[model samples]
Every structure is written in structure tokens, then in C-alpha cells.
Target: MSLQIYDTKIGKKIPFTPLRDNHVRIYACGITAYDFCHLGHARSALVFDMIVSYLRHSGYKVTFVRNFTDIDDKIINRAQKQNTTCAELSQRFIDEFYIDMKALKITPPDYEPRATEHIPEIIDIIEKLMTKGIAYQADGDVYFEVEKFPQYGSLSGRNLDDLKAGARISINKIKKNPMDFALWKASKPGEPKWDSPWGEGRPGWHIECSAMSRKYLGDSFDIHGGGEDLVFPHHENELAQSEGASGKPFANHWIHHAFVTIRDEKMSKSLHNFLTIREVLKRHQPEALRMMVFATHYRHPLDFSESGLRDAQTSVNRLYNCMAACAALTDGTESSKAVATRAEIDKLRSLPDRFQEAMDNDFNTAQGLGCLFDAVKSINRISQALPAPPAQADINLLRRGGADVTKLAQIMGLLSQEPQAYLAGYQEKHLTAVGMDKAELNKLLEERIAARQNKEWGRADEIRDLLLAKNIELKDSQDGTAWYVAGDRGQ
Candidate 1:
């Protein structure tokens, strides 16, 4: 079946036909890098991550681009508050962004361009808009004239009159209408500045994505995604500027993930309700966070609550427990693996169909997760009946199941760590004390084989306990036992 995705512009599910065959290009509006990453940012990251993961798993070459708005009001103000340059401050947050994404297991985008890094691209786009008469210079600032673009509100479904009414116009004497947004902002003293036809200034938030998307992807791309809050003014203006400048459809599909609310209220740093990934990881496993985020559909609002997380934790634990039991089971007959293999294959084959179905319908993550949970159950059941170390056939099935889980989880930025590591409170010291490091743990585990083969159950159990005490957990397979360190398992 064709991969179907909901097109935000048309508000319907449509087959994804890439501009180029066997290839997909995606653009996700990345964070502004002004503050610590928040749940809202996580949602956007995960949303597109899933899209890319599924596309690749489905055998398409995916070029994913997620940009950083390294220059913005918040970034400038933050730098000033910290008594630093905008570039310095942005660099700090960029580092933090990577750390947070890594902790959440979010795959790095194929191209992670920064807005400040793409100044030339932004200038070229502004030049195009100027030549097309879609944008004009006003008081040394380039602004896209709202009225000049006939399809100005087509994406957001609001006309110029309604937009003018709803928009909050500051005391800007040069703007012809309140709805007119900036393509470029004139630089202020002490702020980051770039040389442009409009003087030393920076590109506006909307223009950066359009410019970066065009530079890295093309005049048109397959999907452009961001948070729902960006639907207006941000994403809306991106459409106006990109299509208006290029005179081509900017993107074939637009996907927006919903916001995250805390305690049934809007989450704001001012409200002190903003939940950072670091903060969340303090109390829950990364996989738990993944499950929590995916419990609801990407296009729907997700409420943040302690109770909700507890539920997710419970669910992930159940899956792990089932897998552990499967690993522990020992069936005498070799044919046991073959029987388990057939069952596992059936389950694996069914995964893509259901997962795709959910993703096709507006990126319905909730439904996709439902399908994933079903697959997890099937895997656990097959494991229960498999031979010890699982028949070579069963071992293959286990690997496939692991891949299925890992693939879906990668899209959600979850489960990148070894399962055992995730369950143990792994630390660097413990990793080193294991007489091995992450890179060497697999080989060192071979030494333990002799003890187990010698039927030194007492010695083998001691080694396992020692590893566990050091925040490393082991999973014994027919081949051998492997270990992982759990990063965030308890609060």
C-alpha cells in the first residue's frame, strides 16, 4: 500500500509521492535554541523522526532537514541577560539541544542547518520576493506585503481582512497592514547582525525555514512539520514567503504536532510548568517518556500529568518483563524455535501495515502506538514458547521484534539504548568498573561463558549480581549474556 499522510493544507490523507522516486525530502522547523528544550520541542522532533524512520524502513532514501533558529528575539535577549554574544548563547543552547535529543534518543537529522549559517540563502529568498514584488523594503526592514500575495491566507484559511483584524500590530509606521509580517528585521545595536540589502539585520523566523528548506531540500519538498503553535504567523508566513518568492508550491504536505499542556493548563516557563527533557528523565525511563508521548496522537494535544507517566511506566515495564520471561524459557526441542519463528514473522509482517495506517491518517501516533503495543504483545507471546537461547530461528525472530520496536521507538526518539542499560541506572564509573567499556562489553561477556558452561551457577549468579549492582543488567541469550546500563529508570 502507498504511504499515506495527512496534508495539513488540504486536511486529508493523501498518498506521499516524492518529487523524486524512491527518495523523500522532509523539513521540520527546529527549536529557536534560546532556552532548555521543552516537551513541545520534543513532540516536533519525535513527530518528524517517526516520519523519517518509517520512510527509511519502507525502503525510501530520506533526506531529513531540521534547522535551528539560532538568531531570534529570545536568543538575543538571553545572550544579553547572560552578558554574552548571541552566537555564544546560541552555541550553548545548541549544545544543550543535542544533549537533550541524545538523552531522548532522537536521531540526528540528516542536515541540521542553523538560520545564522544560512544567511546567504535567506538573502537570496528576500531578493526573489523583491523582484517578484511580493515583498518590499520599509524603514530598512524587508516586509512581505500581506495584500500583495493573493493566496496570503490560503494555508491558514484566513483572508487578509480577518488577519488584519486578528493580528496585533505594534506601533510600526512603515507597515501597510497589521497582518504584514517581516521577511527581515533591521538590526538593533548590540544584536547579531548580517549585511543585507536591508542593512545589518537578521532574517525573520518564518523566512529562515523557507530559505533553509529551499537551500537544502528544494523549491518544493515532501513534508514540512512543526508544532501546532507555529500554524499561524510562523508556518502561515513560511507558505506566503516561499511560494510567493519561488512561484512554486513550497511543499506537498504540511504536518503539525500538537502542543503539550501541563496539569490541564498551558505549559509556559513563566508559569514554571515547562517540563524539560532533562527534568523528565530525572524521574522516568526514556522509553517511558516515549510511550507517554506516543500514547496520544501527534496531531492531538497531550496533557502532562504524573499519573499519566506512571501509566506509561507500567506499560513499558510489562513489555520488558514479558521479554525477560521469554529469554528465561527453555524448550527442549529445536523445532520449538521454528514454530516460534512463524508466529513472530506473522507479527512482524503485520506491523508495517498497521503502523502505516496510523501514520497515514494525520500521523495518528496514538493509533500507531496501539498497533505497536499489539506487536509487542505478539512478540512476548512468541518468546514464551520459544526454545532456550531461542532456536536459531527464534533468535532471528527476536532480532526482528527488537528491530520493529527500535524502528518505531527511534521515530519517537525512544529506546535507542540497549534494553538492559535502560533498565539499570548506568553510570560511567559503573560502565568502567565492569572490567569493560560500552565498546568492549560484548567481548568481555565472552569470559562469563566459561563459568556458565562449567555449571558454576553460583559464580555466574555472582557475576550477574555484581553487574546489576553496578547499574548494569544482563540478558542471557542462547548465544550468551549481554549487559546494559539503565540511565533513567526511577525518579
Candidate 2:
């Protein structure tokens, strides 16, 4: 099926046709850099990341731009609270954002512009708006004239009257209309400021995205994405400012990921329920969090909970175990069984098409992941049916299956680790959680191996029971007995 994306402006899924053939230009509104990223930020980042990945995988030359709001009221306030300058505070959090995105395996955008760095572009847009009579200066402050733009609320579907009634307008009493938003804010004492036609001031929040996106992705781009919360005021204002200034559509497609919630409550710092990406990574494997995010449709709200994360961890464990089993069957030796398993391997080749079909439908990662799990199940079943030390043909089949699974998972930024390494790391994490010392566990394992070698079955059984009591179980393979946390053998 052809790619279809849900455009928030039109409120329906439409075919994704790029303005330029064979190329897709996308701009996603990035973080404010005032604090560490949270689950909500992860969802938006991963959603757009997956979208860009799929677009490129489908043979489109995608230039993705995501901007940082490094100079904002929040950053200023946070800087003061932390006893630092705005630039210093914003830089620290921007660094932290990169770390979080790296941990999540999110692909970096082609252009990551910072609002502070695009001051010239911002000033240029503001100047254009002033010349076009779409913006006016009020006591050194510049405000977008909402009434001047006939379609100001078309993207958000809110008329000017309704917006004026609902908007929390600035109490400065300088704007001509209640709904007029600031394009440039006159600098206050002790605040970061830049020289502009409207005097020394900084660009407003909405204006920053418009200026940065235009600078990198052009005045009109293919897709503009962010969280659903940005649909109004943020994105809506962006449309007015950009279109009002350039007299062209700001973006052809509008995509927004739903919020990440905790127990039905929005996860926010104000709510005291915000879980930073770093904290979540420390508690669970990063892949597990990625899995949890992809489990739900991108446009749907995701409920964050410890149980959900644990379930996702279990799912990732299963995939890795399947990979490990497939790896074990593919030792370099040749066997006759390879020919017999060829059909199963051939079946695995069709997975990419299935995965793509799910992703093409508005970047439905949940369905795409479903396809991945289905392949995992097929590989596991094939492994069980294959004989130990099977024909070279069977080994090839298992190898093919493993390679195909890894390739598909990599597109979603999962299964990047070696199967053995992932399994071992997961085992170690569980061991630590259960307070099992690795050194002590290793000593017991060695003693048990010696007992089994000497035919002291009772003593070996005793050691097994002792380890099991601590939630560690021993799996005996041809090489040796390996210990893992009990109840987590990827069963």
C-alpha cells in the first residue's frame, strides 16, 4: 500500500505525496532544553525517527530537521533557579537530550537547528511580517496581527473570535487584539537579549520554530510533527506566522504524536509524575522502553507504568532468545537439513513486506512490531523442529532467518546487540536486581560443574537448588552450565 499519513489539519489520513518527487522534507519541533527529556519527548522523537527511517528505507531521500528552543522563558527561569546563565543551562540540557536520544537509539535529524543560532532568520521573518502589515510593533515588542491573516485558525479549526475568548493573552495591554501572539518579546532586565529592529529582545516561542524550520527545510516542507499538545497555539501560531510572512503553505503534512500518560494522568513535571529518560533507562533496558513506546499506535496515548515496562522487557527477551536459538543452530558445519528448512527460511523473507505494509499506513509502529513478533514466533518454531547438529542446509536456513529478523528489527532500532551479549546482559541485570553477586554465582557454578564431572549428582542437585532459591537457575548446554535468574529464562 502507498504511504498514507494522518494530517491533523484536515483531520484525516491522506496519501503522502512529497512536494518534490523522490524526496521528503520533514521538520519536527524539538525540546525546549530547560530540563531532561521525559517519556512524552521519547514518544515524539521515536515516532518521527521511525517515520524518517521508513521513508528512507522506502527509497525516499529524506532531509529531516528538528530544532531546539535553547533560549526560552523556561530556560531563563531554570537558569536562575540553578544559579547559572541561560546559555550554560540550555547547553547542559541539550547535551542531556542527545544522551537520551542516543540511549533510545533514535536517529539524529539531518539538521538540528537551535533557535538562538537562527536569530538572523528569525529577525528576517519578523521584518517581513512587519512590511506585509501582518505584524505590528508595540513599545519595542512585535506581535503577529491575527486578524490580518484570513486563515489564521484554519490549521487549528478555531476562529479568531473563539481563540480570542479562550486565549490566555499577555497582560501587557499592548497587543491590538487579545489573541495577538508575540513575534518578538522586548528584553526584560537580566534576561538574554539580541539586537533586533524591534530593539533588544529575543524571538517568541512560536516564532522560533517557524524561523528555524524555514531556514533548514524551506518555507514549505513535506511534514511538520510534534506532540498533540502543540496542535494549538504552538503549531497553529507557526502556521500563521510562516504563511503570513511568506504567503505560502508552511507544511504540506501535519503529524502529531499523542501524549504519554501515567495512570490516566498526563505525565508532567508540574504533576510531579514526570519520569526522565535517564531514570527510565537506569531501571530498564532501553530497548524495553522503545518496545513499550512502539506497542501502542503513535497517534494514541501511551500509559506509562512499571508493569508495562516489565512486559516490554519480557517481549524483548523473547526476541533475543529466539535470535540466540537461531544462532546456535547455525554453527559453521554443513548438514542435509539445510535443504529441508529452506522453505521456512524463504517464508522469513516475506517479513520485510509485511513490516513495511504496517509502517506505510501512517507509520503504524504497533502493527509493524506485531509483524516482528510474528517472525520471532516463526523462527522459534522452526528451531524447535530442527535437529541438533542438523544438515548444513538447516544451518543456512537458521542463519538466513536470524539475519532477516535482525535486519527488520534494526529498522525499528531494536535487536542491534549480539544475541549472546543481549541475553547475558539481561541475565546480569536480573541477577543484580535479585541481589545475587556475580562472583559468588560464578564460584557456585564452577563447583557444580566439578561435581557433575565427578558424577556427584546429589551435590550438583544441591547447588542447583541453592541457586534456584535465590531466583537464579542453571541451564546446562553442551558447552557448560550457564546460570541465569530464575523465571526469566525467556520462557
Please provide, for model 2 over 398-437, each residue's C-alpha lDDT reduced to its tens digit, 9 standing for 90 to 100: 6776787788787778898999999988888778787877
List model 1 lDDT by residue over 96-167, tens digit each.
999989887778899999999899999999999999888889887988988888888777777888866766
lDDT (Cα atoms) of all candidates against the true structure: 0.78, 0.87
Error of 2 at 278 (Å): 0.9
**Count of backbone collisions in candidate 1:** 5
Among these predictions, the greatest lDDT belongs to 2
Q: Quote each prediction's TM-score.
A: 0.79, 0.93
Q: How far off is residue 387 in model 1, in Å?
A: 10
As a TM-score, model 2 comes out at 0.93
Give me the overall lDDT of model 2.
Answer: 0.87
